[model samples]
Target chain A: MSARAETLPATGLRLPRLGLPSLDALGAWTLALIWIAPLVFAAWAAFHSPRDALAFDITAPWTLDNFAAAWVAAPWLRYFFNTMMLVTTILAGQLVLCTLAGYAFARFAFPGREVLFYLVLLQLFILPEVLIVENYVIVSRLGLFDTILGIGAPYMASAFGIFLLRQAFKQVPKELEEAARVEGCGWLGVLWRVYIPAAKPVYLAYALVSVATHWNNFLWPLVVTNSTTTRPLTVGLSLFAAPESGVNIAVISAATLMSIAPLLVAFLIFQRQFLQAFLRAGIR
Target chain B: MSDTDSLDRRRMALYGWMLLAPALILLTTFAFLPTVTTVWQSLFSRGTARRPAEFIGAENYQYLFDDPVFWQVATNNLIYAGVTIPVSIVIALGMALWANGHLPGRGFIRAAYFTPTMLPMIAAANLWLFFYTPSIGLIDRIAGLFGIGATNWLGQPETALWAIIIVTIWKEAGFFMIFYLAALQTIPPDLREAAVIEGASRWTYTRRIVLPLLMPTTLFVMINAMINSVKLIDHLFILTKGGPNNASKLLLYWIWETAFSYFDRPTAAALTVMVLAVLGLVAVFQFRGLEKRIHYR
Candidate 1:
């Protein structure tokens, strides 16, 4: 509408221009600046000496010493490995469990299906975080304490994943399943050939959401894992940057950047995919 | 023929149960059974070196009702929710409008707005911790230019929770903006054209046409924002540890401290039950109240 009003000039009378620069654009740019300032500051402080970082010297010499110090201060490589293992374990578990459950709900004719489905949906509200007290006891009683599996166990069967995949599988054309079955495919073969292939996009969207979530999870892992061998990057970064450790600001910023760098870099590279993934997964 | 039909029916049922077993076991273990156990455990006394575990019905609830710290933490959480939810939603709407419009550098602006959501809450806390540090903190340094003296942002009782609230808003607004942006794109362009032809002012168009159309999305976002108010307490672990006499303590953090830090298991169970009750109320309100409104619209 604004574009049409500007270009056509159909009316003889002229109206005042809204502004020299569009106020909408100006406001957006300002907000963007405020939003990005913390990240920009982190980058600036991480590259310079502590004195230079505090001084905000524009012409100061940049050095890698902060990164070196940060690396030596914590066992970051192990933390990274742990986070990767944790995310992979949770994602793989969720895909298999949710796919099977969703397929059963979407296709099977069973008694009490509606009630059972509602029970599954209840997990969406009663998240594991809310059940932390009893969940801790359950994890320990299973003799999985202080292990990576303990951290990943409670979240392996995701209700959100099951809900999404159920929606996707329901949209699959019935003829395709019958065709696969007619070609001498059994139930498992039909699922592998038809339903799974049809729901690839949903799987991808759910995978992105799940990866980002488990990668950033902190409290449960902090409770379950007692050693550096199992602590993910977020918990490790928190402990490393704790004020009781007496780490300086420059090195702390460097360590913070290291912790978030993988997700940050992945987002920047696949910005469109990341945005679309959220939109797809969230709209339901 | 009848025997074959019955056999097929039994086989189908078996397949269904086999497929559902894994997810049902997990959900029961992690979510459903734990909720029941939390309530059950709250009825028992915390066993220690001196005494065996015994059921003491309503004692924990009575204690929680009388505990001053529990009351204070609950109040703090309410204030935290009251401030963060509305402020973040409004900012997110503004961001979505800008990002969805004919703005210069739209891609960069949208990305800049959303970068915070991509970063972990713990990392965000680490970055902001530098900003809130007294004297040497960037905020104090900037204020120093105007001859204002250094003020303790995180150390003092008065300013600490507000400082945490500011960080929470910063981290969340961008995330909510994505949902708003998605909704904005789904709005038909013809509605704006019709409003323009009718000489509706921009504000009027937005107020009358756009907002009503976005009501469902707003309700959805509101529920998400509510859930986040309870979920995103990771930053507290880094920033304050609910410190300065528990001025910044939230309900979940208090639960953690009670159970893990103090080894008061029954009290923590009671607190957990309270948190669950609050969440359940919100869920019921959303489903019964707001959902009807959305459907009517």
Candidate 2:
């Protein structure tokens, strides 16, 4: 709002004649600079050698010591394996559970359904973090503590997943499902052949979001797992990067980069689809 | 046909219940059960702040009223939300503006902005901690270049909360902007086009047309931002640990401390209920504000 003072000429064509009113152009330039700086700095620290990274000088000697030192600091391979197991379990369960729950809520006629649905929506507000202590007690009692399942279990029935899929399923049109049923297709067939395909985009979007979110989840894993054996990438990476032991900036950035490398690489490959998914996540 | 149809109808109802079993059970056990347990456990007693628990009516609630830490934590949440919400929303609004224009490399810039929001607080917190480290880290070194001496960010009580607020904004702003970006796209192109036809300045068009169309998104964004302010504290474990002196301690972190650290699970439960109450009220107002502005058409 502050950027426009001289470019309005009372015509739609004026914008082209004016070339973005100068100030807005400058404002855009400045915002881009501020937003991009930290990640660029992280990249510089990650790729450059330690001496170059640590040197107060802007231009200095660069080498591969930072990456090498960062790599040797801990067993990142194990952390990656643990993260994979953790994410796969959570997503796998969410897919099955959310689809069923979503389909039921959307299509079925049942008693107390609205009340049950209302209670379910409340989960979206009272995130698991608020009730972590109670959750800890449950996980401990179940003998799931320190197991990958413990890390993935509480998140298995995602309210967000159910809600998103429900929205998609409700839009699938009742007539189509009825016709399929009349044509001798079973209910399962209608779901698999009709509802599921109709909701594929929502499913794809939900999958992207679920993976991005759970992959980065920390508190649940921290509460459930103690040892590196079960700790996910975030927990393991934090242990190595935390400042309590006085970590150096250069080495820590290298570790941070290595940890996020998979997700970051995935993002680079499916950048457009990922951004579109978030855009469609509908302000949540 | 009639007999089989009756059987099929009956079976479908049974099948619906079967399908809902896993998700309904899991949600009830994990989410709904804990919420109910928080209220139930809060009412029970532990018999002397140091003993095994028993049912005690409202005693924990009464204690919360008397406890000085409750007020302190509430105030800290206010401060955290106060800074984090507006800063994030404004930054997001600004980010959206920047990207909406024909800028150089806008896509790459948007990705850079949105990167931190993509990371779970755990991973992102590690990256920030490295940046905020005392002597050789990025923030201090930049301060050094400006002739300022290195200072401990998370180590001190005075700067700790502010430090957390800054990082929280850094992580969240871009994510909020994605909503704004989507909202911006939906604002009728004709409104802007008509405004330009009327010689409305770019600033004027945005202030009057774009911003209003985006108000619902803003309200929704701020509500989530407020809720995040109250809770998102896993990152606190690695970054501030809630303090050298509880300076950076947030409400939920303190609840965590009370539950596990002090073994005062009853008080923690009471505190959890209080936190939920406040969040509920904020959420109500947030949604109400959004509903008022929502242009469903």
- Candidate of highest lDDT: 1
Please report the TM-score between candidate 2 and the true structure.
0.90
Residue A85 miss distance in model 1 (angstroms)? 0.2
Instruction: Evaluate all candidate structures by whole-model CA lDDT and list the values in order.
Output: 0.88, 0.80
What DockQ, between 0 and 1, does each candidate earn?
0.55, 0.45
Model 1 chain B: worst 10 consecutive residues (lDDT sum): B285-294
Return the top candidate by TM-score.
1
lDDT of 1 by residue, A6-94 (tens): 53231111233666665666788999999998999989899999989988887999999999999999999999999999999999999
Q: Name the TM-score of chain A in model 1.
A: 0.93
Off by over 4 Å in 1: A1-19, B1-10, B289-297
- Model 1: docking quality category: medium
Could you tell me which 10 consecutive residues in candidate 2 chain A have the lowest summed lDDT?
A5-14
Question: Model 1, retained fraction of real contacts?
Answer: 0.65
Candidate 1 lDDT over B169-276, as tens digits, reads 999899899898999888787777677678877788788987888887888888888888888888999889998899999988888888899988899999999889
Which portions of model 2 show Cα errors greater than 4 Å?
A1-21, A48-52, B1-13, B45-51, B283-297
Model 2, span B48-117: residue lDDT tens: 6477678878999998889786777788888999999999999999888777655557677678778787
Q: Provide the clash count, candidate 2.
A: 3
